[model samples]
Target: MLYKKECKISSEGFVIPDFDFDSADAVIPISTPSITQYEFDSFQLYLDLLDAMKHDKSSNFYPSILIKALKMFTASIISQKNNIPNELLESYDTPGTLLSLIDPNTDKTVFLEALHAAIAWTGAVKNNSAFSVPEFILFLIETSVYALSDPNFQYDRNIGNSTVALLRNILFHSNDAKFHFINNRGVELFSSLYLEVVGDTLKDYIIIVIINSLDVSPTPPFNFVKFVENPLLKSVFGYNLRSATSLEIRLALAYVKISPECALSFLNHIEIESSGIEFLFASTDTQVLLLELFEFLVTCSNETVVSIAEKKIQWNVFLPHIPMSFDSKLMKKTIQVAVNLFKIGHYKILDTLILKVLLEMMTIGNIKIKHRAMDAIRILINSGSPHSMDSIIGHNIISKICNFLESDRKDIFKFCFEMLLFIIQFALDGKCPRKVRDQLYEAEFEAIMEEVCGCELNEELANMADILKEKFDQLVAESETLEMAELENNHEIIEEEDYDDDEENEFHDNHFDNMNYYQQYAQNCMKGIEEEDESENESDDEEEDEWVDADEFPID
Candidate 1:
């Protein structure tokens, strides 16, 4: 294979003794053959290939020539020691025209081969400043889209993979390429292609395209809200959440950052199914994305949307899985979400569940998790309802805080102190139930406060401890006052009950005397009545005898 060779020549008409081909000043000697006859014939053949491809718009006249031209163009750009020739670089324009020949209904074997060539060519010239023209990049993207749009183009096939590779190369080359891709309905088209593609590889490529398209800083030019609204995009996101690879999950996460609206929409879809939360707890990458989306929703400051998210996402189902999450970063975000929920006051039912998780996390070795757990506890104690705050006081929460207060970790100590201070203040202010205050008292709450108050600490911890001690005293005073009030009330009730008992006993005695008097009087009356009855009976007996004698005489 004869080829053109260039040798550096000195200005003195003698070849440089040490000819450095890489030197900028090196030049080709006029005496040296820049092209042999064979090289000239090869160049001519390359030109003919380009011309043939240019005219073969339908690709009917030697379709292989398009593939040959694509390879030759890529190879020329890569192998050239100097600048790629204008003819070779300009040959990049022919692929798009040849791609137009591909029918969505036709077999795509040749069309895919041509696309692979274009991908190679684009990747080869990606770094070449001279070839990074808008026109060329759009042509590469359009050709890739056309090939990908083929209904018969099997993504698992070599052709479909090549087309995706080509598109990725073009889209990643520059922000402009990505912008043009999105502006030209590239997302819509790729989303459609993604649904039709079967293999993970093609799906991954599509995900990368969407990610790279929206990955620009300071606002990408794409319409992310509309992108998210697409059914295909939603399905892709849903699929990624459930079963896609980690890289795909990451790409979906990056895509979600494009817009708060997009994140909300994505989250809404994830919220539709428990499988989404299952995947979140199962995969570390997806969990990160879930947290980010959650943060976005919380910070967006739209209460209606946040409430909708709270309702749609089963926080009860998700809360129990926090302890099972092994990733500290993920656990931190989970705590953040819990804290935000507490701040929002929507998912109040999760307060106890979150409190338990936070307490459990406080015992973990991970400082971030522990810190976030404290933050969540502080938020709940500060802003949570009295009932919810009271719920945290149990399960040895006081003991946990006291133990954390004794830790060597300053963050833990500080956080624990702040939380304790909040709890004590909450108790003192009577925001918490009396039961909680008593529980704190039973947990050696005063001793813990005094221990913190006496320790030499940072200004913040010391100040917090002082406040906690003052509040603790006030809480104790109030509790004692309440106890005295209850005792006084009980004493008054006892005195009143004793008086009622004495009065009832006296009434019973008086009623008993009256009944006895009545019985005696009745007995005397009965004795007199018996005497009267005897007299009346004698008189009636005499009258009856007389009447009976008269009747007997009459009968006789």
Candidate 2:
């Protein structure tokens, strides 16, 4: 009795030929045992031929000559229904002998023919289930992984990749095979092999195996592919249309889904520099998905998990994708990541670009995105990366945010005042408030703050505004105190405010220290961030230089 053969792994699913020996017709019971034995003796010659060729390939003529003969003769063992594979399996060592021939030194043609025979033996469907022979299946996988691991071993990609597909098929179809695979850290060997192996077929198979394994949390024993595998972080990031399918972006998503901890393990300072940020430049779906992964990593509530994600995923990397998150439609995940970046409080990322997106989001009628955009802007101020709004921090911004102060959207009014306070704070702190002070006066900043003081808003918002209104009056009075005295006292103050000058990152940490609730909202999304960090500290080594080829991308 084979287990459920319907796996939604690929378009053409695998038929798991896991036969139960308890079933009546598990194997054809040969009535004449000696007759079967006599026929089995003949197929032993094929195995012997492989063994002898392995010992001496001096007659290179003969072994190359025997490649087809070996494939046909060995194929007959299962294809002819001669009971040879059955009799051979009864003895433990025989199966290993057939598999042991899969070697780096073996002729590619002869080795593939032997692998074909192994597949037939393992995949033989009617009675003899290949799954029942775990010893042989495991051996074949172990050998194939070794042969494929050889860096110097190069073959025609079609042949090489066909070898990968044939081996992948055995695992593709059987749960028992997959169990042996994951536990043995088959991912470690194969991910390394992926860098060395040629052929889109093999690359495609490995990517599927990885996505299938990491995408879903399998039950015990199969749960963590990370236990031994590297997930080939370096290679996946460096991929181009010339090297692999664009599905690498999907691989990044599956990888992040593993756990925040798992993400940081390979997402090192080095790895992050290589590829994670580039996904924003790919297709829109890819950009949105990549943002979703960043949202998960940055928003995890677990302090340790959050720490790992934040350090590796640099905030400065996301400037390009931020605007798309504020698109006319609700790109909820993209905004979530943008919101997270604000919460993390990196001033390098919270620049004029974000201000533009925020202002645009406010005017759009898309209620869903508008609210999130509002939340993001409020978080940005509350996060205190206010210097970014300095370039255009004047009457236009003051008037726009003040206009929303009347919005009934549950005190989008509260943030309207807060956004104003930040502009005021920058004016005073950057020591260059004349322009902003004038804009606030032009926008009736005092009257608006005075009115907000009377509105039914939260105590924090009210108190924060009350403190700010007084500051606004002082700001206006300071501007008028004496333009000549102000200029004379702080002549260089205006030029000192350039963010790109010598004092760039120098100001970020200082501003973040003032943020009222910088990381407070990130924890709110913790429930959505999955916890698959079963082994956080497992180490992965770097892979060798890539074996390049293959132009096809996987279909969605």
Candidate 3:
């Protein structure tokens, strides 16, 4: 029973001969007794080779030399049908076992050293072009993570430096065939290792490497094949892509290219909101990758995006993508996020988008989208924008204000009462659209009269009344001087005859405040002067003096 499958015969008709046991191979009976014994023996040799090579830097080739022999021998034994070792369920300290060489509890430092040596040995054995060795490499990768993660054995910090160097070679310097092996191996196995590691800080460095690998824009010579394309990678990535940290899918998304199917499937795989806003905004890579992902995400099915938002993403994540020239799919997503945000107490976002849409909403054709835009504008004014529109005070967005001012929502009209204050205080044009300005003026005048008459008022509405009173008093004072000058000219003859102290005192008493007094006195004096002039004309039998209406009457 050989768990390791034999390589297919190449075009060259070569079936490399196995050297461990003397029998033809059969794939299905991999866990038989002979196979079990053979695996145990190979494990023993593997540990023995690490033990022999530990202190010997003298022979530069010792690790490499040992690994080639080990690969050859293991290949031979596992290819046999009858002498294959059955699966052994043994603990770390079991005698003659691979785990015994790196037992975590006793002599922990020595155990990690032994495992590091094994990894170096694996790397040294591979030929420059050699790529996949499913069983051996998987065993090495999984074993390394297990050993490193064991609490009993603390990994040397020095080992990370060496590991980084090795990974750089595998990711950057290797041939195309080897590159696939390393990348596929990475995407397949790194997820579990990531979960086993502690803290997001360390995860950031790993994420950087993953992002760099996915950045194929300047086009690296080798194809950085997607994990979704390969069944092994898809199985492996899919299984652990949602492990207890962001490292899993964060990296998967960094590598996701143009496949809408992968994008849709991935949205379903993870709980998106688990990646916290604080954590995401904290990372430069996460931000960049998240943006790329949303660009891809919007293209996915509506059910998929909706489900993802229901689970993981926040509404704010979609807000930054809402400028005028975004994808229609993304706009739809924005609306969906807005709707959810609205349900949660973030209705302010709806207003902001609507104001933005009014500036650019002309191009959007969907009826629901337009209705949402219109409703948002009305909602915002009702919220606080109307009172505080001056605070937003001077945006060029003023161009879109007219349509909103005339909205049929009476709350809209009511809100504009305060909007007039914003315009008067801030408008560079002084004159906005005519109908709007006139209504604004009428609201101001009524508010002034209400205040002057000492009426009780709503808080904001009362404030506007005060502003209007101040403006109105200034206008009345200017009108008083004009009436007085005209009266002096018209009453010349009457002034010559006036001598009574009581009559003069009464005239002064009646006209105390300038604007109110002068307007009343001038009206009465003009009627008397007209009547005397009419009597003089009637006596002369001339009716022309009586023909004038109130329009002909002078202010004095």
Candidate 4:
């Protein structure tokens, strides 16, 4: 604290310690008339603060002190200009010492100023490179990122642009430093920004930014198959990953596009400790994102799918969130992904969760979600989970699938048929529930089969007829086998009754033969009479019987 007699200031007004400026070996005396040199000297203090910040980041002094220093130093530089244009100070690029006026306790004000200042500084440094733009931009971004306690930061244009620029820079330069930046701040800042601005009026711009971000390549980790384990990114974008609408999905797909490597990473992130879909899949806004994600996942390798199914259980998020919108583009992509995942044995990830969620959501979901849900459910029932077949079949998923076949939607009916076909195939492989299989054989499932058959028999529903026939035949065969077994058992019981002698046996055989002959004769007579009679002719012929015969002879 060695100061010249001229440098006099009370301890209370100076939040920054006197020792803080000691690092500036080239400090100019305060009495010097050259204010520019003083500004530069004070600017040196800013550098010392940066150094100090790097070492000890305790928030002892509120951000107001930093704001005050910026105001005082920048003002000192601006005032020295003899005649400054007022517009220059108020321009979008230079809001001028406004940062100093902010009260640190008022975080919203500080946040806005800090955001504006960082943006303005970036532009200012680029326009006027008497200072280093990269270094200054980094510092400003660093400061703004630190001031994230305020949720309102994302709404400002300056903040939005700066945040996008920072991300762009990181994506363009996929070096260690930038990667770490994205890995650390990418999820929190970017996701928070998205959350704040998701449904806001300027969502168009935000979505465009996301689209651009996803377009970055060669995707994270240089491969699209590895699971990314970043907590912050997962926390923020996981829900968005399953958005019901196209916009949120488009944004999520952006991350996957740049780094196909992110596909497994994201799936891993969403995987919960236990099985069950999160409420996010229930969100009407993001389920479409989940569908798109699965579509992307299908493009991944087999080993990737296998690894995901083994460790992850989050596919349930997609179960409840079927997108009914039927974007041919998205649907095409989704069907491909689902097929691939099934081929690779990822169906176990869905299992009972798919059936449970779909059953609850089918009637209640939007047309689009419902449609997508039906598509996924059908695929699931048919795919057959090798590891979890018992769980799937044990839950009565087959009955529900049969019910979906009766939906009025032709697309749904066709999907249900395809599903039934798959179910038959899987059953042949012995994957169906034991109880359900027995019911199919016992003719007990006929009512449901009849309804499904009716749906398939329509000329317009011919596409589903083959599958319906296959299921029907399988069920009928099972029923007939049971019936034959029952009949055999009854015949054995009748034969068990013994006769005392040969003569008694002979009488029993004659009796049985006569009864059989009479039954045949009676059956033939009944058949002929039914064929010959007609409603009109029978009414005319029987009219006499109905009248005279009853009136004249009934009493006798």
Candidate 5:
């Protein structure tokens, strides 16, 4: 190396250091009475290093990306160990230097070394070292994803194991790291890779990575439905819940919200217990996450998952039991998940018990959750899930919807208007259950439509209102005929009962024949009674004739 420490003893007996020899680039050079530029030239090596990095990078980072990054990383790390910021010694581009190590083209051999270096440095720099930046974590994850995809790395299971292990530290420790990992598409790439590398070797880590992806819930979501559809993720997450570590099992609960299909894949190995429900559906801490997952899952349109969520796990049954805490953020999200479940055809989620919970939430005085609940009911009302509309009408929801229709809060007003509109259409269609529909007033709904027609409502509500008014008018026109039909039906029913009464009279008039049987039965009963009386009389006469003057002659 050009920079090294050496000393020579001259005849004068004082040690003089080599002019070119140096220990660190950031070190200050000796001062002279007249300072010259040449004596301190060595101090410029950091600039040279950066130039070299840029030069090598321009030349495809000569030899390899990992080597270039590691050298720069080593320099900064050495500087950082000497109570110096690596940026001061290694130039501010040191983190950028480490970034090259993760280029997807990195070969398997270099990648293995790179992963080890990444993992080691991750812990080494924990005391506020330069490598401890969030970008470093992102680098490791990006490298791991690339390495997992590299065909050269496929032969080496250790590469995957190391990459996944590194990810565990990065993902579990830092939310920012998790976010970067997800945004980097590490979830999907890792999900895709596990299918290749998993021979019972890396499923745990890969699944945990995808599971944590749901934690950050990265945008442009990993095609969870697409993965399940291909059986790619299905096979990757195919392992039993029993085979998973407690941590993996626990983190995987996030999947229920993200992809019920994948969660079902995990449960295929074991039956989900009540505890599973508690973790995913009942935990207030995870309510937001559960809600997020539900929000994503509904869009996937997997009926099997809906079936499991509704029937097997009984998500709806436990939902009402989960208290609507004053934490409106969670309550609002909870309402959203409930709406998602309703959308997925878990109709029982609209049961009065749960609706009561939602209604209470709407009235809880928290404007956000109130609006959220109102909007949620609006969604249910417009969901066209016969039960959604029925839910609005069946319980306290209709009143709340009507009252909120006049709310000064425009959002509530809009939501309630939409709800009332949908209910009117629902009632007009006669889709609602008789009892629930009975709770709905045609006139109240008609009046709402009339207002929508007359008011300066938005074009959409106005048009729908006009259409509904026409339908309502037609229904009203038919009501008189319908009532006449109903009267005739009742008349036919009354005549049928009178006909039955006449048949009864005819039977009474023909009762002589019936009375003959009765006479025989009565005569037989009287004859039997007379025989019993005569037998008792004869017994008494015999007892009297044989009687001694004793009062207890009956014993003889």
Candidate 6:
């Protein structure tokens, strides 16, 4: 029996000539041994050509011709009614050979064409039962990862696009392939290329690859966070016009969605020394994205997420952006994060500058922010540490709290009153500086409490106000008593100093007198010794005179 088949021209052909294998009149029998031999020989010829191209040291054969040959061979194998025999498939090793040809360092055009050929061959063989080998998938993954790992590799638009397409296709094949790719840290390698590449041509493809990989990854791998937290990605958080694209923001959002804790990782990666937040805020869209991310993190009840958020005490980078943010939702969420942080006892890290910002929020911020600001203040005051109280009082927070008492928002008024009560208690306990207590009294805080008492407040609020007034009165009296006692102690100290000074003067005078007496005694003793020596000299002279006279009288 003779069989005839027509071959459809593949769209993948570029410079390759089209053959009329589909000619209606050219019929070949399926059972013809000679035709089968011819098909095998043709396949072998292409395989031999591939081997030659692989070993070709020089540019003797153009990559275009080689790519066309690859495409034809792949098409032939795919178009055959029957599967390519296992022996032939193994002998050819077309996928492995095509993978080897993908040297990113080669000529850009050649590399791209070779990449396209390899991608096409992989796709063609993916449907072939005989070619469905796990080892082949591994080879594709390893090759793609290796190609992407070349730091010095540069890609033109075509090469970059096609290479990414190739990677994405391989990743889409099966979960096993995707798993292998991620396990090899392929996403990390490709993400690093974002910094290495000159333009945004490959950005979209890279993002898609990352998204797909993460989608297929089981239980969100740790590396997903690592990839998102990569410094290069964080570098984009700055106000660079090039990096403010919606796609990049989406990429960031995707990362955070993978794990809320990743948001903390992202925050950690932000270089505060650089104007990273400012740059991000410069773009309204980027600002919105960041605010959304922050809001998500704050709202997340995950312990790890909350813990990470709490550790970020440095709010300087976020300070400028918060007040300037036009998004009300974003602002509210940001204030909530602050509230949560303060509740966790991060008040010690809150500096004067941040406190001032919070004070502004309480006074002029929207109702939501003002409410949150009140909560934060209450937490700080309730900490009861002298330093915390000092930070509050140092910023003239007492005045800010007083202003809140006049607010129409009952919640604000109630919170303000409670905060005042706490502050007064702190003062009465002497945990605050005496100066702070004095300032509170000078601010006519008692008058504010009386005013609150006159308002139609709820019973709880009214009772709290009355109690606060009573406490204020007692605090003032106690403060006065403490002051009087301090004055008395000062007087006693002065009296003690005066008595000690007099005693010291008397001791010094007595010491001088003793020294003078000792000096006179020594001088008198020396004078006596001198007088004795003079007498002895006189005796000797008399004796010598007598001896001389005797000598004159007797020579014996």
| Prediction 5 TM-score vs. true | 0.45
Model 3, which residues run further than 4 Å from truth? 1-143, 151-157, 173-188, 199-202, 208-252, 255-258, 273-285, 300-556
- Give the lDDT of residue 127 in candidate 2: 30
Q: RMSD for each model, in Å, please?
A: 13.1, 31.1, 26.2, 24.2, 16.3, 14.4
- Whole-model lDDT, model 1: 0.59
Order candidates by TM-score, high to low: 1, 6, 5, 2, 4, 3
Global local distance difference test of model 6 = 0.60
- lDDT string for model 6 (1-556, tens) is 1123433434432211222221222111111112244554577687878877877847656667776665555444434524456676668767667666766566555566666665445443443322224554344444544445555645544444455655655554556666665676666776776666554435555665665566565655776437755654666755453446655666666676666556656656754234334543355556556545554554555767655554542355666556665456555655665566566654534553566667666666777777777677666666665676677777677776776676677887778778778777877776753665677766766677667667889888888877877887777778788889999999999999999999999998899799889888889999999999999999999998777554557555
TM-score of 3: 0.31
Off by over 4 Å in 2: 1-185, 192-236, 239-247, 253-281, 292-330, 344-348, 383-415, 425-432, 438-474, 482-556
Estimate the TM-score for candidate 2: 0.41
lDDT of each: 0.59, 0.54, 0.42, 0.46, 0.52, 0.60
lDDT by residue for model 5 over 266-318, one digit each (tens)? 44543444433444334354455544544443344676665554544445544
Number of the candidate with higher TM-score, 4 or 5? 5
Q: Looking at candidate 1, what is the lDDT of residue 527?
A: 93
Question: Please, what is the TM-score per model?
Answer: 0.55, 0.41, 0.31, 0.39, 0.45, 0.54
Residue-wise C-alpha lDDT for candidate 2, range 1-556, written one tens digit per residue: 2221221223322222323322322221111112233444567666566556655667848656566445544444433443446554563343354455555466765565555555455444333244325565455455656555655656533334434444444554556655666555556666676667665545656555545444333542323455322446555454541232445556666665566555555455225543345644555555565556656665655556566666665544554355545444335655566677676664434433555556666665377677777787677666554455653462256766766665666557566666667777777675667888777667776676666677776777767777777778777776777587877667567567554554766566566664535555555455334332322322211222243345555557
Which regions of candidate 1 deviate over 4 angstroms? 1-159, 169-185, 212-242, 246-271, 275-277, 298-303, 335-352, 368-399, 403-411, 433-435, 442-470, 483-556
Error of 3 at 240 (Å): 17
Q: How accurate is candidate 4 locally (lDDT)?
A: 0.46
Q: After superposition, how far is residue 16 of candidate 4 from its true place, in Å?
A: 31
Best model per lDDT: 6
lDDT of 1 by residue, 1-556 (tens): 1123443223522111222312322221221223333443365466566655556567564556555554454344323424446665475554444344333333454454445445435544554332334555455455556545665645424544554565565556667766666666767667666676665555666766676677655565436325533665456455545654555555555665676666556666543456436655356666666556555554555555566655565555665666766668667777777776678774444443667777777786376677677767777666747656556664556766776666666687777767776676667676653665677767777777667666778888777777767776777778888889999999999999999999999999999999999999999999999999999999999998777445546543
Residues forming the 10-long window of minimal summed lDDT in candidate 6: 24-33
